[model samples]
Target: MKKSIYRLIKFSILPLLFICYAIYITGKNTGDFYKRFSSPQQNSLILGSSRAASMNPEIIDQIIHSKYPNAKLYNYAFTWAHSPYGPKYLESIEKKIKPDTKDGVFIVTVEPTALMVDKNKPDDPQYYTENDKSVAKTSMVATNPNLEYLLESYDFSITNEFNKKIRPEKNPMIEVSVLDNGQVHGKVIKRFSTEKRKEVNAEKMAELKNRINELKISPTRLEYLSKTIDFLKQHGKVMVVRMPVSKVPYDIENSAVADFDKIILDITESKKVPYINYNNYPNNYQWVDEVHLEPEFMDKFSAVIAKDLVH
Candidate 1:
């Protein structure tokens, strides 16, 4: 009996060792590889979902450095990063974000959808990414297998009645960080006609109209949104930025946007925090489309906001 027990233990040990080694390798190779490369001379904390993560952190960093020359800036944008994650990580973030300069700002993007609480959603790297080179960020595995229609699309405008799976992870890989040669790295998988706006807008309007009719926002989401507002208040003045979307208008009366507007209005009014609603804000000549702008426009917009609010 003693000899048999020893054999069992020995067999179990090898597999356990193999499992631990795999986890360590995955964590090391795929984890926030970007953060390791970026110089930590940053002072400001830039937070948000994929849209927030999508912006070139290095640009934001340069913007902060050029505008507020004395201070350094780190782009801490997390993909699919729900606001609730903010308060939880605020302290540790503060540790990484402490700059040589005294005063700094925390710029968090407001993706209205992130305000809704998703219960038990799986992880997804395709939704957005931290490190541009991380494996999940570059994986060929379909982001949402159910939505087979979107596999070849640069189309961020579609919403389906089925489960919407982003990347493999629903949350940001907070354990990993991206470094600051930070530029937004995405491939324009396709470009439509000059009349592309009309095609895109029409597709978006129809899809959202169908989905919005069946949705309801959760209370825990509301609570987190409120907490996020308060968290920003505690840190510095929380500048709630409504990041631009292709933002095709919803059916004016009973569309998906009414739900978003109601939530946005409630958060801003109740919290009384200053916000930049660039979602509906007009785009100038340099815009990539009516909603999102070119990379240079990011600096222009960031500088304008920094000047108007932070400065």
Candidate 2:
């Protein structure tokens, strides 16, 4: 019995421990969202959906250093489904920020989709899409491993997560890495041909049009956004930004919410913060799809934003 138990410990327990250690090491690369949860609490933060996730904090910091020398910005932005402007995201933001942060930079990215809900049940928080997601469910946001997030939020098996790092996918269209600074870096490995890119954009635009009726602007989301601005105000300066999208989806957004820009303008004006609308800016930027900027443009875009922040 003693010999059998010793063998079991050697074969089973030791291997399990090694596997767990492997998973913990590769956890950050397993998904785009894991590293965001695993990192320490941030002083400065960039808040929005995936559109804002690509903004390089390093570039922003370098440019803004002359003004706010100690600003250490982390991109806490997730996808629209997970991080739309709402109570849950605000709660997570509050938890992720350093308690004594003062004179830190806060960049809040906005778009119509972020503030939308089910048209039929716009008032019901239960029906809100993000309520059941990581932003809402994750109570501990500043742990190294963030086992709570891994257990509750991660969809794949630990084996799969481990395999992702050990045996990576070959020739992926986009390779995404989460930096220590909390930026989601996406490298486009396979660029679509111009014709193929146009085709994909059209498909995305069509999908947006089809789903437009299912969603409606939510007053709760808007109020929570204002509350988020108010909460961040105590810590530092807040800047509202609308990242540029391709004209196809841009027009769709305007049609979906006729007063989108006006609404954002009103909020910025009332809050006395800067609102930079890149949609009206020059159309020289490139996109991976209709919404997100290509990896090459991220640093350039961050530089533009940083320059604006200082001025």
Candidate 3:
């Protein structure tokens, strides 16, 4: 009986330990979202969708340190599907930020897509897409080796993550790395040819069109955006920014929501926070797609934002 019990314990405990270790290592090395979850609570944060994920927190810190000393900015931005202004994201943000934080900087990036929800059930929290995602479901966001996120939210296998870290793909189409400081660095291994660029643009346009049909601007989400700003106000300054995009998608967004800028301006005015619309800036920077800024231009963009914040 004693021998059988010992064998059972060995079999179960050993594999469990191995899995825990593998998960820890995987969280440390691979998965873009994993590193964000494993890190400690941030003093300052950059919040938005994938468009804002590539905003380099380190670059922003270096440039803005003189004005706001020791301000550690973490990019808590996820994707359009996961981080739209809603209760789920607000809950996650609340968990990620330190409770006692005062005089912290918060950058909230705005776009039409993020403020949209399913047209059929715009008011129902139960049917929200983000509720099914890690950002909404994960209870603990500031813990090292967040086991809950690794087990539930991590999409890739542990073996795959290990393979990526050990033997990275050579000349891959794209390479993405999530830094300890919570910045997501995505490198385009090679620039797209003219034909390839056209193809990508067409696909993105179609996706945007489909979303326009399926979703609508949510009053609930807009309210949450206000709540997010109000909550961040207690900590410190909150800057609302509208990131720049290429002409094609920009036209579509503006056409979809004619009053988008006015809506954002009203909110900013009411909240008494600065609103910077980079869309009004000269479109000289490169883009990976119609919406996302190219990684090469991220530092320049971050520097511009940092300077704008202080001046």
lDDT of each: 0.47, 0.87, 0.87
The list of candidate 2 runs beyond 4 A from truth reads 1-9
Q: So what's the TM-score on candidate 1? A: 0.52
Q: Judged by TM-score relative to the true structure, which candidate is superior, 2 or 3?
A: 2
lDDT tens string, model 1, 8-125?
9999999878655543333233323332222343455666654555455455445556555554444555444322233333433444444343556666666534443333342332
Poorest lDDT segment (10 consecutive residues) of candidate 1: 140-149
Best by TM-score: 2
Question: What TM-score goes with each of the models?
Answer: 0.52, 0.94, 0.93
**Candidate 1: where is the Cα deviation over 4 Å?**
1-42, 56-71, 81-96, 99-102, 118-183, 187-215, 247-254, 257-262, 265-272, 285-292
Measured with C-alpha atoms, the lDDT of residue 69 in candidate 1 is 57
User: Candidate 3's residue-wise lDDT over 262-293, tens digit each?
Assistant: 99999999999999889897858987878888
Alpha-carbon lDDT of model 1? 0.47
What's the best-to-worst order under TM-score? 2, 3, 1
Cα lDDT of candidate 2 equals 0.87
Model 3 pairs whose backbones collide:
none
Model 2 per-residue lDDT tens digits across residues 1-311: 99999998889987889777866765556544878887889899999999999899999999999999878889999988999988899999999999999989999999998999988774667788998898899999988777898789878776775676678788888777788898888766777899998898889878888777678998888999999999999999899999998888888888889999889898889999989899888968887777888777878899999999999
Model 3 global lDDT (CA atoms, 0 to 1): 0.87
